[model samples]
Target chain A: MSAMNKQILLKSRPNGEPTAANFDLVETPVPTPGAGQFLVKVIYMSLDPYMRGRMGAEKSYAATADLGAPMVGGGVGVVEESNNDQFKVGDYVMCGTGWQSYCLSDGTGVMKLDPKQAPISTGVGVLGMPGLTAYYGLLEIGKPKAGETVVVAAASGAVGSVVGQIAKIKGCRAVGIAGSPDKCAFVVEELGFDVCLNYKDADFPEQLAKACPDGIDVYFENVGGKVFEAVLPLFNDDARMPLCGLISQYNMTELPKGTNMLPALMRAMLTHRILIQGFIISYHFNHLPAFLKDVSGWIKSGQLKYREDIVEGIENAPEAFMGLLKGKNFGKLLVRVADDPTRN
Target chain B: MSAMNKQILLKSRPNGEPTAANFDLVETPVPTPGAGQFLVKVIYMSLDPYMRGRMGAEKSYAATADLGAPMVGGGVGVVEESNNDQFKVGDYVMCGTGWQSYCLSDGTGVMKLDPKQAPISTGVGVLGMPGLTAYYGLLEIGKPKAGETVVVAAASGAVGSVVGQIAKIKGCRAVGIAGSPDKCAFVVEELGFDVCLNYKDADFPEQLAKACPDGIDVYFENVGGKVFEAVLPLFNDDARMPLCGLISQYNMTELPKGTNMLPALMRAMLTHRILIQGFIISYHFNHLPAFLKDVSGWIKSGQLKYREDIVEGIENAPEAFMGLLKGKNFGKLLVRVADDPTRN
Candidate 1:
């Protein structure tokens, strides 16, 4: 292994949309692991929309990433050296590797992964945080029932894809909304969604209304700008929404200007008995065991599918994440920091 | 018995706040009950905030009150005549009596009330709809835990009074908000709330903050304008909101002009994992039996107390209802259409 570890750090907070100039790519001497610690050589680092919130100095659900420090994230990697009895050399694991090629861990949240069981990259993709997020948010909060209609936006993305497939597994009519016709087709055809609508179309709202002939029962709220505005009016009485993320609004510098519509929104919610619950997966880790088992089984049985859009280097993370905010990435956006030994 | 049946009929739908000019008082020839029917002489008519929603021709959770039809409401009255086996002469019962001196019923939704057991007027107040609303919206939706803080608006009124008392019963710190100092005192002294803030005061928000040292865990949303604006900022992580009514917005002619705060609100909801569930009490009839049992027990044990604001005469119901929308009534607003024989 090289003596230098390449890491991406947050240089400054963005006023609105993030730019590459706001991040710093640096190479630092790899630190040796201390007593009861291990070193993991990162293979894949996850780039999620949630990271944008952490970049800001404001108080947030997740801890803010300190400026000039490694941007916080999770990754799948192989243990290169270990002093801890639980983790051994040559063993693959998933831990908080951040936006770095090499990281030191004391195994607090480290989970040993059997690369032979599934593709190693999946530890940072479908079988990891995103998958668990989809599982808990959809089943626990969304509570989709049989014959009910479940709608999710960013349908081709990691969380939305899993949410829709799980809706189908639960006997619901799963409807997806994506930015492009291609992504929409992939969601409907490959992922087995009942229908997928391209939200970019001029008559997208009308199309959504037509797609959901029966009003939406469970709306997995992922991208919440125009998509939510469209779904708000079409909600069935007693609708459940698991508010996971608002990707469309994350880059906003300030609130939009218009007629204050909260009263109207509250009215709609009350009249329909809609339940909107915001959840962070970390707080709901108690659901991890069931989520892993069910999601793994679904993947094996062809009831679920995942797609990855892997960017090549850690230095490219800032651009890839910026693209993610603009709906530029096709699927689960990941930064491949090093070669996966199991892949070859 | 009077030879004529007097009823208040909807003359027209009001644009915002209801007016006396929108209703007509008419006398119809007293109709004799046909087979399987009974005649009821309304004694205590319930005047509730939810009535305003039905008065509109727009789509709402409630059925629209047709022009020239008697405004819909529940009432406690005596069965004057009966062709139905379920009812007999001089038997007090609670049923849909509308705004009328006399009503004909076929026994559906009619609950026989015993004047000997409790005050018959309670069928529309504490032991009835408003009481059940507080019980269900608090225990079921709010789910307050011991030592947690629960906040409610319109604290001296029907639902809010019950909500705070129930929070106390569950070992929670109850904080209340009311429009007047007298109402605030009544909420604190009479209803056993830990604290009550008069919202009309200039430093009301600061007073609310001081009242709740711990952040709010459950917010029983009743009035939604300024009161809601005050409560929204103090919600703790994992706060649960039971949206029972938005009485403040009912008389709004149009949405207020300002910067759209929905994004900021959504961010707050997400960061705190808040659960805002809007509900209409009518659909949850399954919870009624449990509500009646618990609330009755609490009232009998002196753990819960109730007050009624009674306005005499059926002709005054329109004005009473309008006053209710403006928060003019101090307690469970009710129109006493005739003498409550049970009272004397």
Candidate 2:
């Protein structure tokens, strides 16, 4: 009755733009469930930009993932063995299972999923962290008002898509900046964004400025560097910037060479009276109930749409993650570790 | 009897730091009070850093001073003759009189000053714009808490001095940054700041870091550039910055040669979740009554102290103003256009 578990471990710390060499695929014994615990056979693993931050030793909102240990992440799984009364065998659950085919978890911080409600894999994507992140980061920090311009980067991805849709719902002009033409198309056409600029375009900055004629009111800052430089001069007085992530600069080994930008940025912030606040989504979980209620209704009513780029098998997690970092993946990126019984 | 009225006119806009050549002292016949108007003999001309912004044709919180016109500023004056019932001859008042020895007002924005209160010149400095600037910028925006560290630049000048004293009153450690050892001494010894660092010192950044043991919670940004660079790294999470002015960059012809500082500043703003906002004091005039009551009480109770650096005679204004920009003047820089009867 014994089975081997497939796991992806952090083989080495990345210098810049993490490659497959930084991760190792290893076989380990299936974890046994003790009292008040359960063994999960992970079905889906979420691949996110923040994982890059966790791989580094630098202090971030989340602690660094230890080397040669299972790379930290959240996953949706089926409870195969359980001693806890709250989670039974065959129960669908979402927990911090890292990048593994099977993981041991206590009932703490794990949420049970209902099969009839929606697709269970969504427990890690639009219905979970990314969704909540877009919700609070935009509504709470950006405070987008009717007719205001709301700009978000990584437009076709999980959080950015939701942010643009929500901005539309709030009566704002949702402008998106994505890495490719396809991503831009998906954002503007499918996600109902007013305009989506391709950051890869040589005229991206000019196009961005032309798109935001009244100037940007609420900027959801996910990508930093060039995208930010374009957005800076176009900021209207009293613009609010919700700085959720700096994905563009995550792989930068050293600061880019230039005149120090800190003074000019301060001058802009002062002149425009911009409110730039960086935040971790987990800290503001109190907005979860409201987010779920509103977003669920939107999805059910066809007002909100989501796309998933799911890769098959646990062994491909590292490659998929690298793709995710390079803006190669479209929509909410995930690794399908095992069969989702609820899906089919 | 005919008296010639002297006025300082803007000769031409300077490319960088303004020179005496930019100002022209011209004489014109003084006008008599018309219907509903009063004649003011300007006594104290307040020279502030924000005047630098008005000289340029760029859009700001206030309108640009017209070329070939008298330079715009606030002044404390005596109502020499009045046709308006609200004002009378020999009464001291404060109004936006520009840089002139005589001005005619309709009593629209003029405020009657009681000689019995503080000195009438303070109507432009401590009890006026600078006082209000410090009060609102610190209390409303910075929101310094007990035991928190508050840092302000231009420590011995009008606004910074008040900001430091107010931070002290709120039970926070007040650190001042100034250009010279003498200015630093006045800030620490006379204004009761906990410590004052001279930005002119070679080890200024190190000294500033050492001074802020708990890291900076509140930074009152009056002099931007190197002082801001020193403060940026020392900011704690959730630090609040009230960016009231950037006196250092006011005279710069172009941005200093170096790495573009905007990205780095944005990162700091995001990482620290800092709230940096620029404001002009006149916009927040709703706080005037409360400001007057509290500040006057502090001055009377010895909880606050004020020092005036008055340049005698109208002819010395342009040179005095240039000195004011270079951190040459101590305390609030005021040009005495006429005898202050209240002072004697």
Candidate 3:
């Protein structure tokens, strides 16, 4: 084990689009655990679009990341040292370890993980917040009935991939929208989505309309820009939209220059009786147990599939995170901060 | 009752805003009730925002109004002659009688009303569809908890008045927005809202924010142009919005010119985890019994109040309906097609 801990700190708020200069990587001597505290060696750190919202001083559903502090995020780690009675050394756990190699925990929200059941990295991926988010949002808000057409954006990403798989399991036609042709292929061939459209295509809206002949009943909204505009007109009466993220608009520092389409959207909503709900997964932790059981069962039965885009080292997190905003990562983007002992 | 049936029919779809040229008033000899049908002398006809959507060729939640048919609307009336077993002679009933002095009905979607319990005009106003809309949308979608701030637009209108009153009954701080000072006064003093703001005021947005100091927990959206713009920034975390009507945008022929604020609204929704849902009351008639019981009790106990803007004669129906879109009506806009026998 390394004697020194490497931490990525939020140096400044991003100006429009984020750059590597917004974060600072610093090293400090690893500290010993206090009386009831434990030290966790972070194996895999999550890089999500939501973290971008946290970088701004504006109040989000979750608290903003403080400048000069470790960038706020969740990670799966190993309890290397423990004085706490509940958590012990060698126990694998999931906690908000942020962008760091190691973090001290008193076990406020730490969940003990079993490496024998699945890959330890999945504790931060399919078996973690992203999977739970997709499960709750799709079932609770989207309410995709059997034979309904369920459309989800960011098709090959963490949450959307699970959303489409869950839709298929629930006996619905899952339509996916992705940035590239490769991701589109992955969503269809690998993830079992009924149809996957490349949103980058010039005739993407036309393709989307052709793909959804019955109209979209459930739209799992993650990317909200031109993508949302395309999905807007094709909504069936009583359409349900479970909105969790707007990756396309995250870097936008200004409102788009165009005729205000707010009224048009509102009119369509009324015409179709559409229901749009935004949610942050942190507020829904109570749903985690049910999600874990259902998702774990599905994963075990091969009804659900997940992919991890693993980037190596804490130093690469900034560039990878920036790339994530532009849809560069192919799947659940995770930074492998340290060697996974469970893998050996 | 009149010997001749006087009807106002839709002549043409409005280009931008509607005018008298859009409708035609025609007189025909009163037709006899056929087998299993009854003749109704229409007394009060409802002029609602939803009817505007029906006038357009573009599909709405409900079907578009036929070009030469009597303008589609609900009305309270008396059964003058009856061959139907269910509807007796001299019984007051509510049905889609449209803008006509007399009509023949086969008893579908008709609800009998008793003037002894309350005014029969309320069958199309406070005790009918408008009341039920407010009840279900507020309780089911808004889900106003005790001490929550509930803001409703078109405060003096049928649906909005009931929304504010129900919000108060649920122990919420009810804030209302209306078009004029008198309407605002009626909303606060007569309808018992905590505060009411005139949307026409230059500082109305500021006033709304000040009124909802704790932030709006539930916003009952009926007037969805400028009123919605004001309510957008003041939403609390996990705010609920039940969107039933968008009166301000109903007559819009083209998109408004400005920087598109859709992204800003989406961002706010995500930041606060807001839920915005649109509903058509027709789909929710199954909940009519519960809504009728609760709202009737509230009205009987004086906890809920309602006002009607009655324009006499079928000739004035087009003008009154035109005035409604401009917020010229003081309360629930109703056109009196025939004299009410119950009132006499």
Candidate 4:
């Protein structure tokens, strides 16, 4: 076991797009396992858009990660030492231990991972927070019935990919909105979505309308900007929207300029009796067991699939994460912080 | 009875503010009741801002009144003749009988009025749709627990008045928003609202913030536009919004100019886990019996109060209705189409 650990800390709040200067990498002593605590050597770190919200001082669903603190994130790790009865040395687990080589946990939020069933890295992606987010948001709020059209933005990414696939499994037509043709193809051809539209296309709205002939019954709102504008007119009566995230406007310093269509939005809601709800997965933590059960079964039966874009080194994590904001990553973005002992 | 009858018909679709030229008064032979049908002499016609939506060709909850068709509206009337076993002559009932001196009904959607309990005009105002709207909207969607702050726009109008009173009954601090100082005064002094702020006040937002120190938990959205803009910033985490109507923007021919704040609205909903639902009373008609029992008890116990603006004569119904859209009526606007036979 290494005596030294490399940690990334938040230096200052970013005004708009985050820079490498905003994060400080420092060598520190590896944390010791306390009573009922386990020391983990992180193998894979999840880089999600939600972390952007944590970086800002603005109020969000999750509390802002304080400056000068190790930037908070979800990661899969191998237990190096254990004082906890539930975990033992070399047991693979998923936990929010931030951007660090080693971390300490007391088995509170940490969950055991089965490398035999699926890749250990998936414990932070497909069978984890992003996957759970899509499952609950779509099933609980979106409530897409059979034959209904379900639309999701950022469709090639972690949450959106799962949302699209789940919609398909529920017997609904899944429409994906991605930034490029490659991402669109990945969503449609790889993830089994019925259709995928490039949001950057000049005729994106027209394409969306054509794709959703029955109109959109459920809109899994992950990216809110131009994609939202395109989806707005296609929303049918009694449309249900589960607002999971808004990656498009996360870096926005000022309110975007556009047609003030709030009245229209309100009218659509009132006339059509639409239900639009926003949620965070933490609020529905009690349903985690059920989520894992259903998701695991689907993955095992080949009814659901997931993709991962793994960056090899922790030093490249900030750049990969930044690229994720710009819709560059084609799948769930993760950093390989250390070699996987379970795989070896 | 005279064979001749006066009826108001849709003449033309208005551009913005409806004019008298948009409505036409026609003389027609009164139609006789058929088997299982009854004749009604409309005594009081309800004037509501929602009627504006019906005048346009645009799709809404209610179907648009076609040109040359008799203008549709809710009214309380005495059954002048009956072939239906359910109704008898001289029985006061509430029905959607259009703007006319007489109407023929096949007994569907007509409710018998208890003249001994309250004024017959209340069948078209506080104790009827508006009252039931406030009752169900607040209790079901708003779900204001004891001590929660509930804010309502158009506070002295039919629905808003009942909403504030109901919130007060539920041990909540009821804050009212009206257009005029006099209306605001009536809401606070007469209706017993904790605070009343005029929407016309230059410092209205500040006043609303000051009035709701704990923040608004339930916002009954009836009058949209600037009132909604003001309430947006003060909405607390997990706030419930029952969108009943958007009267302020009903007359809009063009989209309003401002920052597209829907992303912010979505972000707010996400950050707060707020539930915003739009509903119509017809959707929850089965709950009416329970609502009537609860609301009637509140009114009789002096815990609920209502106001009515009664305009005399059916000929003035058009002007009275026009005033409703302008927020000119101080209370529930009702046109006394005929003499209250029971009162006489």
Q: DockQ winner among the candidates? A: 3
TM-score for each model: 0.98, 0.95, 0.98, 0.97
- Write one digit per residue (lDDT tens) for candidate 2, span A132-197: 999999999899999999999998999999999999999999999998888888898888999999
Model 1 steric clash pairs: none
What's the TM-score of chain B for every model shown?
0.98, 0.98, 0.98, 0.98
Across A1-344, the per-residue lDDT of candidate 4 in tens digits comes to 65678888999999999998889888899988989998999999999998999999988888899999889999999999999989999899999989988999999889999889888988889899999999999999998899999999889899999999999999999999898989888888888999999988899899999999999999999888788878877778788989878898889888767688788788888988888887888888887888889999999999899999999887788888889999888899999999886676
What residue runs in model 3 are displaced by over 4 Å at the alpha carbon?
none
| Model 1 per-residue lDDT tens digits across residues A189-238 | 99999999998899999999999999899999978878888998999899
lDDT of 3 by residue, A1-344 (tens): 66789999999999788998999999998879999999999999999999998999877778899999999999999999999999999999999998999999999999999999899888878999899889999999999999999999999999999999999999999999999999999999999999999999999999999999999999999899999999999999999999999999988888888788799889888888999999988888899989989999999999999999999999999999999999999999999998988887
DockQ scores of all models, one per candidate: 0.83, 0.53, 0.84, 0.79
Clashes of each: 0, 12, 0, 0
DockQ-better candidate, 1 vs 3? 3
**How does model 3 score on DockQ?**
0.84
Model 2 / residue A17 / CA error / Å? 1.5
- Residue B325 lDDT in candidate 4: 90
User: Which residue pairs in model 3 clash with each other?
Assistant: none
Q: Deviation in angstroms for B239 in model 1?
A: 0.4
